[model samples]
Target: MKRFKHLLPVLLLLMSLTAAIISCKKGGDDPTPTPTPAQPVTTITSISPATAPVGSTIAIGGTNFGTSPTSNTVTIGGVVATIVSVTDTQIVVVVPTGAANGPVSVTAGGQTAQSQSTFTVYVAPLKPVVEISGTTFANQNWTRDKIYLLKGLVYIPADFTLTIEAGTVIKGAAPDQDPDKKNMAGTLIIERRAKIIAQGTASQPIVFTSAKAAGQRAYGDWGGLVLIGKAAMNTTSTAALPGGVRGTVERYAEFNDNSGTLRYVRIEYAGAAQPTGSATRLSGLSLYGVGNSTVIDHVQVSYSGSDSFAWFGGTANLKNLVAYRSFDDDWSADWGYVGNVQFGVAVRDPDVADQSGSNGLELENYDPTATTDVTPVVLANGLQQTAPVFANLSSFGFGTTPTTNKSAKGTGAYLAGLYLRRNAAVAVYNSLLYGYPEGVSLGATGATPGVTNNTIDLQGIVLANVLTPVVGNGVLTSDLTTTYFTTSGRANQIVQSSDLTALRLNNFNATTPGFLPQSGSSLLTGAVTGGKLANSFFTPTTFRGAFGTDDWTTGWTNFFPQNTDYDR
Candidate 1:
């Protein structure tokens, strides 16, 4: 009985303690407290770009998308988007391509309002913009007669007119075929009568050269002007040519007929030679059968190999030409050429000569046996001479006398600046000649019959030289320069003023002599008038020098510095 009573008292004490604890729990005074409402899921954090570029992934942020995520999906304007990542408060989804550019609303729930915000996608550009990586043309394929330009070079098919803006710079490409043939160069082959108005002013001259040029690049590093004309090609009745069998003729009718005008153009550092000798070498501007309707004026050829300007057989009329520092002949005429050129100047390096190295002009009848009568060419006020200096044989090794030091087949034979051979007839008058082995040679091999009746009349011609003075042959005598060269040995030098008045009909005052009548000048007031010339052709009276007066002192000078030691 005593033990039972003791146990009952103990149970009563424990019950009292339990009852106190239960009261405390009922009064909300428990030790373990509830978390404060989890900060009410209010003020949602920021979403990483509710708007972004197409194909971009965007982040969505909010209070509890769902602790367990019963359903998780994102949509932009009701369009289902891919969910790249998901978190308790954020979801990342990818914007699809072709997605409309507009304010996009992102939603996560159906019933409950999800965190919605406006987003946008950027639109892509349409045109292809050129960058440092190179030119990126937008519409490469143009409709019929449409003109397209990528980079600076204009690519046109047949029967298309490519209108180029004035002062546009067209860079030639590096040689694509036979790199070792020295055929590594680029070219512009204008087909038929496709007009190309590439005319630039003296202030803004159009430049056609290599990308390596700081101001100017090395000469002959690339091919030059290539104009394919519809005037005439090799004879159809020639039996000597491979394709010109007597019965099978390659007529001129097959050439493309695209006529164009190349006025006030300057071609520099062109005419790279191939392994097939200079015959295959590309000229600065190769006008192949260009029509006589085309106009070529105020063109300058600087630092080139082969001929600066070569006319295969085109009736294009050319005037005001300047050929400076050309490795080969400055001007060359071949095949069926019927053009009249006036006020042409040829300046050659003193180190070179005529026989295989020097000649101011070269006229040739390509198909000697062909009966297809080729047209005649007229040249007036054309100057082909330069001052004499020590023969820098090494500089002319590859161009002037490649065969002198090296074997004939080993290197190559250098041609002259001017070589009139192959039974071709040409007329020249009132010009200047300087240091050259032969100022002008009539025949090439044997007694050529072309020069017998041909007229090469000269009135006031000047031949100047430092080392070996000019020695004129044929009807042209060394006494032509007596009026200009006042110096003892230079008494025969022609005056610039005389050349101006005698060549063209421009009023060049004694004060503003242009390139003529300058004090102590080689060419003073002396020239053949238009009526006096065999062909009554008139041109501007800017003294016949390689450079214009402004080019030397003022204007945007494209001075090609002579520092070849450094790799361009």
Candidate 2:
């Protein structure tokens, strides 16, 4: 009986286990109902804007992205990206910080899709960046902590204001490396009526530089800063000058219209040329149709591939400008620029010059500087003449000492101090120009800008070491230089090169040379506030050629940007 009882307990245990198994089979084991069909593989077809900097929005186009944004997850370079919007076929996501170069991946409905092509991510800022591209529709403020990398032709449309904090650094990314980008440079264009309130302090000047590293930076690494406004210009079409970049046009004139403020700013290693067919390279700061109300002061342009500063059809007044080692002209004005410039300096390198001839002021009314510019008899569209007043300019071109090859890339000829051709009506007072082929090369048959006409006025000038003080370059014979420029009450002096030695500008030929006038030098004397300088636009100063005892370009200017740690 006891044995039977033990067997009965064992049998009861087996029967209980069998019953549990049968119940489970009936409840949950119903033929493993047709397996839920695998989710459609999320296929990535394309990625628009394949290249992007950190903190930029990019589109991921594909299929199988769920309609709800929460259901989809996107990652760039393995870093999680914020999904801005999502659709079944497309997903828009903002490239998050810390993103690196990698393939983009998206996950939706338990299915995943990855891009076959690698996404290029650029982050060349000191710490981080907010990249700017295309056109700025809304008002934006750029801070100083992060360097803004301009990806393409960044435009600030009219009425939109770009407020830049002091000490901000903006880099123009070179587009020559990427064949997909259309433009060869990253340019900043302030369209007509657009405003840029960039008022930097002397200690913390705004800097616009190339994206290359310190040692790798060179001339034309990227594009320059351009300001286009509404102001009177000499040309009917204003297409002659490159103020609107390569082939863009300058629109109707609106005198005294404000563009914006550019004070205590530095634009370094700029002036990159346009794509293939462009004949002209961009300038460091090109003002097109800018108005006098736009303030431009204490601006330094160093290592420019082309001109440091250029104006086309504008009345924009600029002062305290420094043009250091430019490839082309230091200052250029054309297409009826009637602005006022004072307290400017041009430091030329005998080793650096352009094929078109590098000079201090390359003045012209339009593109054609030949005798075809006989419009001196009649103005274009009844606009004002190109009569910009320049005062206290020290254009020191030491061309005699080294006897340079002139051009950086190819062989080029040494030009002049002020090459005034075409129909230019300019007025210069209290300036020093030295060490070129000629101090002032006057050409093109023009009656309005001639000395007899009084429109081409040179009130006070110190001409030294030039092969010819004043000469008609090829077409025009300047009778005024022999009879009026030297003999008249213009206070113009033709000093010998030895006089500059007493100035004590030690090692002025070097890359980082001293440029302060010593005590008892003749260049420090003979400044006047009479004649054309009597106008209110002129700031009355006792010193003559741009500097006397103080070097205004000391703290803010970077003479050796080749080695500067811009990221610091």
Residue 325 CA error for candidate 2 (Å)? 0.8
- lDDT digits (tens) for residues 1-568 of candidate 2: 9999879989999999999999998888456577779657788999889998776799999988989889998999999999998889999999887788999999898988899998888655555866778886999899898889887678899799999999899999897643347766887888888999999998889999989987899988888999988786666563554622433454566678998899999999898887656555789999988898999999999889889998977788888999998888999988778888999988887777888888988888654644543334232353556778899998978746424355555357568888887767688888888788788877656333366666678867888778778877434576755556686577888876666575445456546667777777877777766777877878888777888787887777777778666674
Task: State the RMSD for candidate 1.
Answer: 20.5
Question: What's the TM-score of every candidate structure?
Answer: 0.52, 0.73
lDDT of 2 at 81: 95
- Quote model 2's TM-score: 0.73
Off by over 4 Å in 1: 1-155, 176-184, 213-216, 234-250, 253-258, 274-278, 351-355, 368-418, 444-452, 455-459, 466-517, 520-522, 530-537, 540-557, 561-568
lDDT measured at residue 341 in model 2 versus the true structure, 0 to 100: 94
* Weakest 10 consecutive residues of candidate 1 by summed lDDT: 386-395
lDDT string for model 1 (357-468, tens) is: 5456667665544342233332211111110010001011121212222233212233432345554555443455543433344442223233332322223344322122
* C-alpha lDDT values of all predictions: 0.47, 0.80
